[model samples]
Target: MKLNTNKAVLKPGMTLIELTIVILVLITLISVLFIGAKAYKEGADNATCILNQEQVQKAVRSHQNMNAKNDTESFPHDEVFGATGIISEPTEPTEPDNLYAGMQDDVYPVVGTAYISCTTTNGNGPHAPASTEGW
Candidate 1:
């Protein structure tokens, strides 16, 4: 009587093709996550820029209220209101340049007139201009 011991008949798990497919799926998921994170960061930066603008606007209003009698000629420039040093001073001039230039360039124009311009840095990208309209 001979005993049967043929273990080779059993099939193995997970073929190379299946493993490759799983790896590809994982890579795709990671790519999507990275893209989402980047978008979120940009949005947050935009919000922050807007908030800064609002603060400057409020300060301008306060200044105006304090000197309403001379409102017509009481336009605050960089020197008076320290526009250059509002949030942070820009390396370049914070004049009427590209919108994002001020933020990225590290400049902030005066915020006394009806309209003011604020800019963002290159970190925000071309879409995110360094300058913006203020009240």
Candidate 2:
């Protein structure tokens, strides 16, 4: 009988090409997931900023109600709400210690028509209107 010794067998380990492909796919998937998560975080941050601005608007209206008779001509810069009160300046230079401290800086402009300003780290001024009128 002729010797029948030759046989094909599958390898136990992945081939280099197969391993490379798997690594590439994993990298692509991870990148996509990371980008999606980052976008979600940014959107959440923007929503928080808007909520904060609305609170500031409420404080302004309260101040306006208190000083209706006075010819104040402009919203109080230093003491409409109060010198130490919330809503004194827009965009506190530093991160606030608490929510109230943060609101303290959401002040309306003393001069020309003031609106809720939504700004990024950079100095771009895009305003978001308040939920109610005269914000």
Candidate 3:
């Protein structure tokens, strides 16, 4: 019965080919994960930018209603941001972190009840929704 005990021995470490294959597989998986994460982050940023635009629009309407302003009248950046208690500090759509880019930092004028649009011209990042002219 003990005759076949030493017939085969298990190796402690993987061979070079096995190691290479494993490394390759790991690299592929990691790259896929990174790509998926990037897409997900971009989608999230776009959604957030859209939501911010909607909120700003609502604030503008509220301000206009409260003050009896008309759609033809445009308001300053600070009207909705500081004067009203809606958004204390608006987020600027900057580069790298912001997929919806090209927002001015100091100014976010409420104009004619239209949605706030991102002026990014790169054609790579998120764009404003065509239906409402904003993200």
- Best TM-score among the predictions, by candidate number: 3
* lDDT tens digits by residue: candidate 3, 23-109: 999999999999888777666666665666667666666766787876656556576676556565446344444422322332334
Q: Quote the lDDT for 96 in model 1.
A: 31
Q: Per-residue lDDT of 1-135 in model 1, one digit per residue for the tens?
A: 887776667678898999999999999999999999987876766665555555555555555556553444445354224545333332222233433222322222344332333454436553333444545
Query: What lDDT does candidate 3 reach at residue 113?
Result: 31
* lDDT score for residue 64 of model 2: 63
* Higher-scoring candidate on lDDT, 1 or 3: 3
- Give the range of the ten consecutive residues with the poorest summed lDDT in model 3: 99-108
Clashing pairs in 2: 89-105, 89-107
- Per-residue lDDT over 35-131 for candidate 2, one digit per residue giving the tens place of the 0 to 100 score: 8887676665556666666666666666766766332345544564446765554452223432333333434444233334554432223334334
Alpha carbon deviation, residue 97, candidate 1 (Å): 18
RMSD (Cα, Å) for all candidates, in order, is 7.1, 6.0, 5.7
Instruction: Output the lDDT of residue 30, model 2.
Output: 100
Off by over 4 Å in 3: 1-12, 93-113, 120-125, 133-135
lDDT ranking, high to low: 3, 2, 1
Tell me the number of clashing residue pairs for each predicted model: 19, 2, 0
Pairs in clash, predicted candidate 3: none
